[model samples]
Target: MPSELVFCHPDGGIYGLQFPMSNSISQLDISTMKELSNFVNLLSRHKNLSSIDLEFHRKGDVRAQRIINHAFSLNVQQLTIACLFKKNKKYSHDERVAFPLSLSGSKTLEHLSLRGSCGLFDEEIVLTSAQRFSSLTTLLLHSITLYDGFLSMCPNLKNLTLFSYRMTGSPVLRISHPQLSNLTLEKGECFTHTVNGGRFHVSAPELASLHFFGFCPQMFTTGDGFPCLENAHLSFHSRLECISGSYAPTIVNLLQQFRNVKHLTLSMEIIERLNSSEELISHRPCPLANLKSLTLLPEVATFVQHKHTRVIMSPEVQKYLLSSSPKATLTEVLTLI
Candidate 1:
């Protein structure tokens, strides 16, 4: 038997896999519940599997619970379970209940990613499963809510990624993880439909990398602080109001917050926003004395089409940055319009 098994399915349904008869299997990927059940039953003697990626064929399929139960009980180190939604309907209530219920018993799990259309929240699993995540070091949540104190329960968490989630009304979101080192937030489509809560206040004293893509938060402030941040990447998707004169200052303040960053990546739009006024640059120049490398990403669409094979930066913005951080290496990325 081989140590790894790969199952591929374009749409969905049971698919045949090139299975290895070994019990030392470390990774498994199955497209549908049918295939998953067959493999598990056939390999009944297998108990050393350490990672699994299971995707269900339907939104509310009852068989998904079985996969969750089996996967959770194995205490796999890395697990990703997603029950994709049907055209209009999201997940069934039972499907949603299955995951949290199974997750409550996790003992050896370290990295977990859950992707579903709806109904999964931190609050649902925190109470019973909080203690179970003592070994969890990383988490990725897609289309989930943060209203419940879900994050506070992970004591040893080091990396986190949030996608397609909403945060409303609260004046601030303060995340304080003692060992957290990497944080990425890619705001999904829901960001445009809701009013965002105020500034993001983070307190990861050991944090080293921060990345934000999509809509801009109202404000970005820190608590105990990100004293160890060495890399920062930022990109925005909406039109930033330039006439108000307030946008540039906000950006300057944000940049100043991470003055110690060594490597920085920014979208071309951010530089354009800053170039709107020369006075803004002169008065609030970011003191990036430690900056070693700088990369400017072009428009998202063009960057994707060109496969990021070229670099482009406007002379005006390039000159402004060169003056501020003369010792840092400059990298410009071009995007085809």
Candidate 2:
């Protein structure tokens, strides 16, 4: 193979195949295959393909499955399948069943991303099938309802990212993956439907980098010391104060758990919450001895043309964070546009 071909369309499938000088292709992204026979006939000839991307509109189960079946037949290293959501339409049961079937026989897959909702029933089958990919390393799941049994099956998974999960019933999630070094949890709104929030008990001993954004977890319990964690990003909304008056202590305790973090990022809302009650800090000094870089995000501007470029923190707030890590330089502030 001497060429790569990528075809992306919002509605229909590609009708023609163009290769430069070779008979085989390297990469392909066939979106919404209206003609499965044509796509199968086109891809069956190219055995050297390494990466594939397939996108499907809501309720295109038959077409999506056939395309996926053909794509997985090759020795691909990366595969991305998205069952796009439509605002007015609900996904059919057949589409959910077809989601995991696409990942069948993926032994050599290294990177995989399943975006959009695959429904709860199909997700269980998807997680079960994911375990067969022995070479899998990185996985990203967006808008998925995750549970305890999901990550346990991925023994070889190293990097995991979960976004916008709608969790209820106070689920207790346990992250006990030893090989997972980098973990990211963002855009999560947990425990809205239920009275009690959930708990996440992490046991990633080799975890070196953790980035948390948008919403904070209800509670976090570490299995052991996160000895290898080097970078951490923490952001929380200001509304947390309304949830509980003692959120300062809760936030401080969470920070204390990451004693070995070298690079830490915090939003302005978090800093204000931590410093809201001076009595807590005076009673318990939560120092991050290994911290080297502290980045503050609250001071960031909302728009590009805004006037303020640099943000200043009150002396009391500066002293509070600096006291924990005396060797840390002045906190750096950056805006989020």
Give all candidates' CA lDDT scores.
0.62, 0.62
The superposed Cα distance between candidate 2 and the true structure at residue 120, in angstroms, equals 19
Separately for all candidates shown, the number of backbone clashes (residues 3 or more apart, or on different chains) is 6, 1
Compose the digit string of candidate 1's lDDT tens values, residues 1-337: 4344544444432222223454443434455667667756854455666676766544344455665666667756877866553442354444433233234547688998876554432122211233347788999977654543556766778999877755433445567788999998876434334433235777788889999876556667777556799999987543433223456666666777676789999876567666665576665455676888998887544122333333344565566556567889987766536
Model 1 residue 20 CA deviation (Å) reads 9.6
User: lDDT tens digits, residues 7-36, model 2?
Assistant: 544443322233445666444444434445
Q: List the residue pairs that clash in candidate 1.
A: 1-20, 1-21, 1-22, 2-20, 312-333, 312-334
Question: TM-score, each model?
Answer: 0.70, 0.74
Residue-level lDDT for 267 in candidate 2: 76
Worst 10 residues of 1 by lDDT: 120-129
